[model samples]
Target chain A: MAETVSAGASGGVLGGRRSRQEAAWGYLLIAPVMLGFAVFFLIALGASFYLSFNKWDMLTSPVFNGLDNYRDVWRDGEFREALVNTLAITIPHIVLRLICAMGLAMALNSNIRFRSFYRMLFFLPVLTMPVAIGTIWKWLYDPAFGPINSFLRRFGLPEPEWLSNPRTAIAAVVIVLLWSGVGYDMVIYLAGLQTIPREYYEAASLDGAGAWQRFRDVTLPLLTPTIFFLSVIGIIYSLQVFDLVYVMTRIDQTNQLPTVVYYIYEEGFRNFRMGYAISVAWVLLLMILVFTFIQFRLQRRWVNYV
Target chain B: MVPKFSTRVNRRSLLGAAGGASALALTGMLPKIGSAQDASAVEPYNGEEVTITYGFWDMAQEAAITAQLEAFKVHFPAITVEPQIVPWGDYWTKLQTSLSGGESFDVFWINSASLPVYASAGALLPIDAVVGDGGVDLANFAVPLVEMYGWEGVQYGIPRDFDTIALFYNKDIFDAAGVAYPDDTWTWETFRTVSEQLTDADAGIWGAGLQTSWQENYYNFIYQNGGQLLSEDLSTSVVDSPEASEAFVYLTGFFADELTPTIAIQQSNPVADTLFPAGNVAMLPGGSFRAGTYGQADANIDVAPLPQGKERATVTHGLANVIWSGGANPGAALELVKWLAGEEAETILGESGATVPAHAGLQQPWLDANPDMNLQVFIDALEYAHKVPDPVVGFEWQIKIQEVVIEGFAGNIPAEEIGAQAAAAANEVL
Candidate 1:
């Protein structure tokens, strides 16, 4: 018992001293990253929460204005429009991302030619920076001079204003979002597809299941866990879409495809209404938490451990 | 000890006072601050070596700005100056964050639209401490610009350069279309008629390449038509006025008539950087700042005064170099600001043809840099140049106005509705 008690800090017997030194080494090794997290992430998180209830313009010290920022957010026409845009972006992005990722995963799962080449080709967008992707896409979407409109015009097809028109802008943005985001989900789906037992598909086939039936019964249920993961991740990421829209859709200060995160950025940084921006951020956090929570709860119904 | 404590107190309170417009009465309201020569028996600069950062937005002006910084080193060998170049899009946001973080650049270029915001926040140091005998004088610079940088009678900045509106016509585009080159005698009606003549719908060539931009495009027309964006006190917006409406209609008609490149095309091919340089447009109503850019463009272009509306008027805006109050070294920063205001540095700015120097009678180098083009048209317009209203509330309304204007130029908003919607947008902020 005394020896066990010696496991505590400082100036003990040889064994205890060794263990203590090891513990000290352990803490010393982690101290830099831990200190960094505490300073940057945790402190910033706390400060953001604190700033939510204030009227701070960054230039001045914060003035506590209670629930006014939150109250005003409820009626903020811009916020509502942004939230709707977020939903529009998220739903299409999630649905399309999952479908495309699953299709690609299944295609790759088969013994195909140039398998690694195709995989790398598909995964390249995920590796590329969003800003780079946005800039390239912005050029592609340029109305009069872009290759896309030129292609359409060559065929005498009516080319719609891709980034500027309100009617087509969101859809145009979501298409690019899908192109950039689907690759990450596809790689995850491919890993999940490989994890499923080959015997399950064999058993379904032996039980008179066709290719369609085998896929529906064996592959679909097994991939539910992967689907569940991508859904939650897709919802979180798409809900907070910023850089792509910022680079691609903005015309000076006017954001053509305004999303919630972009709105938060504009309010805090551009407008210098940081207190109000933080409140919107907190609302978005709460929304993401609720969505993730609901997804977790719903996953219990359909996600098969088997 | 007492003097040091009082100086610190004055600085702290000055920052607080500068944070609000209500404090902008007179510097006399606050005690004389910063390097008050007589107040300290001790030395302010002990020949200390300090490295200070200078923030500015224009990459086009970087060459000239670097030349100025190189000169600054010669003047004060101990003070190593660094240029912190942020693009115009990100400059304000970064400046605001850097200030609040207490890691701001020592000196930076500030436009008039943003001066009131920064000055009111006390983020700037009054160079008045450096503005006496044997130091810089306020009278040497452009008077309106000197006033533009002043907050409550304490000047926060020294004017670096000013720009006035001019019509830059591509001689190639004009020649191709068999259209007469624009002259000072041209009026708004003539501009419209020339635009009609120059436009070839079957080809991609446009008659004009005007943007819904504030300074370069509409603001000139609005001022020319005798309109004001806001009332004198800035208590309300007067965008609904008939004069403003007329200007909006006249400018939007170019887009409505499909004479200029659509806003959609301009999004990718900005007028200054691409379209005008590419010679897709016959004429461009742009700022004098574009002279450097156009001077280097592959196309042959010459500038004329903006065509007369109700009266021949243009929008004149200037940039001023300011010292950040929150910087690590204020005294060293003050030395740099003093040198920047001197004629030698201003000469480099002019000679580089980056911009027209705000130092009176320094326009010769910029004009000579592009002798073939009518660069003097920019200087002559300064006689009738108008200042854009900087509202006490903020500049967000200008963004709002520009949004409505973009909508108008895109043909999304009807010509008649442009005024009401734009007025409503400004009213929201004002």
Candidate 2:
């Protein structure tokens, strides 16, 4: 009886040892990735934070000036312009993207011929670089020789200066952004639409709900979670706009389309004020965090997780 | 104890040790120790393999530069010269980052706008000692160029080539309009009259494409009108003066009168460079470097000196070759800079017709390269040529001025108001 008890104890001990060895292997597999994140991301993040409190011109050693860069950000008229422009661009861009993406996604989700082909066509712009898109759109917006102006002229309509004029430059940029970005969000919405079980619609129909009623009761509530996710991400992305503005507009045209990230780039690289750029970046980071936190808090009221 | 140590040395520990070792090696944190060389004596080439990189930013002159490099090999057989060509848009950004990283090129191109920034930062090696030791004559180059590259009495760069603005006109448009070709005696008033006569709104052709460029357009007008962009000490802005305002108004009048393409039209199209060559514009005030491009286009074009305002004046700018202070082989790099700036290299550059060599008496070969047009106009303009006004952080201020000038050209604001605003903005930076 004593031998039997000892044998059982040894068996339990051997099983425990095997599981511990497997757990060790798992940790070993992820160690390199963790180390890389530590070195490249976390360390660089800390360095940037440190740089925000100092003044560095890239030519000389950094000098510590507590909160001066941040104070300058508040006083700079250009910084104010950039902040206002960023918000102006972000709100309209998000609203437009949501409406267009949701509407197109619903249309595309139906039974239609060439569905995969349509999907690929819509996703094509996502594959193109922003610089290439900006350049092509710049030519398309040409007032004299572009096809847009030519079309307008054929209709006997006066053509407004599309990109060069301060009044219309931002609107032109918004149009290009919509053309390039709506497809990406549509794909995400389509994925969400597919996840809705058919029974929900059928049940709603049996309850004497019309098409719009069924959509409002069945589709929207279920898609709220996806919508919530997209808005959070979309707002963050919109606030950080730079590449399109940089490529589409000249230095003289910046007043119409400058965003926060573009301002950061101009200060850091063009003006060689690295410290001030970092301060601007930190402000951008804080703004995004607050926006995302509010969205997360608001999600509880609208998002249905069933 | 030995048996226990052997048991602890497992495969995972061994692999981790190796990975850490390689990471340290790859990061270049390990110290390097080498024997010191004597500082007093200059070392001659002793058949050692030395490779040096030369950075420049002109894709159009690649072939000419390659030929020049080939010629350089004849003088120094042991040293290998590698040419690195970056596009103009990305060149300065890459150069600055490389400089900060302590991995910059042995030598690179410098310009008046960027010379002060780099020289003041101690990123350039003063070449006065090298010039004195080699007995090179700095007097052979244009005085403006020499003075432009020198900061605080320290000559940091040797002039490689120079450029001046000239009036480029399409002969087809001039003939079609029944107008005579522009000459040296042409004044601003004559230019305005001829441009007005040549303009045809229905045909979609303009008399000129007066781009909102400071160096090629407004600066010439400002200087000709006897107005200064900056005060004598270069610490204050003088662009708000009445004379400067008059120049601004004169330049923007072309846009207001529809004699030149409006700011909106030029913004969408290729500006003057394409407009003149495509026959959309009858006249274009452009840099001499554009002669090669215009010559290649399918248009009959000719060059003349810029029309006079108060006096005959033009803006001249040039590129200089400067040695990097962080270069690995300073001696060899200085040698390369000297050779590239000397008469032989200048002669080769001149013969190629790529640019006007800064070396005196080399203009003949460049002029002879294309005999169809009046290339001598550029050489003549050099007599009253002024260096582009470049203060510390001049690039930023130049953009500011362009912004204000563009607004004036758009007719959104008056010239005087814009000029005052621009001057105030520039002074804040200065």
Candidate 3:
């Protein structure tokens, strides 16, 4: 009986040693990945935080100047204009994208012929580079030679300036943004549509519902979760829209399309006020946080999941 | 007995080693040792390979500039010139970052718009000592162009090329309208009349294309109207003066009168040069540096001096070859800069038929290179030309003007208000 107990204790010790060896192997495999993130990304975040507090003009040594940068930003009239412009653009852009993307996704989900071709056509804008898209669309919206004006002229219509006119410039940019962005949301919604059981639609139809009624009762409710997900992502992206606006608008104009991020660029690079630019960046971060939080709170009521 | 023997062995080995080392050190100190043998093993390099890179934003004339660089290499076989060519729109942003980072190129082109800001920041290496030591005289280049490179009586760079605007008219349009060709003596009234006659609505062509472009359009007219962007002290707005307002009102009147295309039309087909070439515009106010481009165009083009107003003035600007600070081998970089700015480099650029070299001696060759058209208008405009004003930060004024003018041309506000708007914005920037 004593010999048996000794054998069992030795076997337990051996098993414990094997488990410890396996745990060591797991940690060794993941060590490189963990080290890479700590070294590159986390280090960058720490450096960015420090840089945001100091003033550095590339060639000279950086100077620490407390929150003077924040004060200067608060006083800048252009910064105020940029903030308003950015909100004006982002709010409308998010609304339009959500409506159009959901509408197109629902329509395309129906038993439609040449469905994939239609999807590919809408997705083409997403694939094209922003610069190339801006160039091509700039020509199309040209008040003189563009087809848009030509079509207007044929109908005895007065051609409004699409671009180059300050009043209409922001609207034109929004149109381009929606045209380029809606397809991405549509693809996401399409994936969400596939997950909804077909029997839900059949049951609604059996209740003698029309198309719009069916959609109002079934499609939109089920698509709310996707709608919520896309809204969060879209709002975040539109708040930081730089390339499209930068490429579409002429560089010399100030009020035309001065998105908040572009304002930061103009101050930091063109004016060489790095400290002030960082202050503006931090303000934008706060604005984004507030906006994201609001969307999250709103999502609880409407974004339903099975 | 064995353990005691092992311990004894260890003690003997340690003491024996220490005593041998001490004896060798004492012996080495007693006699002369040849350190020369060690020094020969690690010799400093006498002939080292060095590379100097340059960044520029003249993509439009890159081919000709490349040819000029190749000729520069013939004189100095030791240095290789590497060029980083970026587009003009993106150039200043990258240049500002590179300069501030102290990782800038050895040589690059500097513009008046951003030069003072860089100078104040000490991003440029003062080339005075290098220019004097290298014995490259500046008198051979155009005096005004050379002066653009200096600030506070210190030379910072060598002017590479100079440009001024001249009237580029489509000969076909003049012939079709039965109007006489514009000459040096032409006034603004005469220019307006010719433009009015040349415009044919049925044919989808305008008489003249007046760019809403700040410098190319209103600024040129402002100088002609006896107005300046700023006072001599660079502290206040001269833009809101009666003369500057009159200049802007006069130019935009063409749009109001339908003599020139609307801002919408011009923006749709943005390139002013393309419009004149394609017969959509009868005449264009374009820079003389575009002589090669006009010469190569399919249409027959003629060049004339800019029309006069209260004063005869055309915008003249010079591109300078500047050496950046904080280079590892500044000595070698200075040699390359001096050579490139010399007569040989200028001659090569002139002979390539690309640009009018900054050197005064190379002017005739540059004119002769283009045999088809009379290229002498550029030289003639030099008499009436004034350099574009140099501000502390150049792009600030440009951005302000563009913003103000867009509202003016859009008819949102009176063109008369443009001066006041521009003045207020520019003063803020200043």
In model 2 chain A, where is the ten-residue run with the lowest total lDDT? Answer: A1-10
Candidate 2: which stretches are off by over 4 Å? A1-24, A251-256, B1-47
- Candidate 2, B317-384: lDDT as tens digits: 99999878767787788778888888888988888887899999988988888788899989888999
Local distance difference test, candidate 3: 0.75
**Candidate order by decreasing DockQ:** 2, 1, 3
lDDT of 1 by residue, A126-221 (tens): 989999999998899898889999999999999998888866788888889889888899899999999988888888888999999998888899
B29 in model 2: Cα distance from truth in Å? 10
Candidate number achieving the greatest lDDT relative to the actual structure = 1
Task: TM-score winner between 1 and 3, please give it.
Answer: 1
**TM-score list, all predictions:** 0.91, 0.91, 0.88
The CAPRI classification for model 3 reads as incorrect
Which lDDT tens digits does candidate 2 get at residues A126-178? 78999999989888988878899999999999898877776587788788778
TM-score of chain B as predicted in candidate 1: 0.89
Provide the overall lDDT of each model, using Cα atoms, as 2-decimal numbers. 0.82, 0.81, 0.75
Candidate with the larger lDDT of 2 and 3: 2
- For model 3, residues B176-217, the per-residue Cα lDDT tens digits are 778888898989999999888988888977888887666567
Show model 1 residue runs off by greater than 4 Å.
Answer: A1-29, B1-46, B132-134
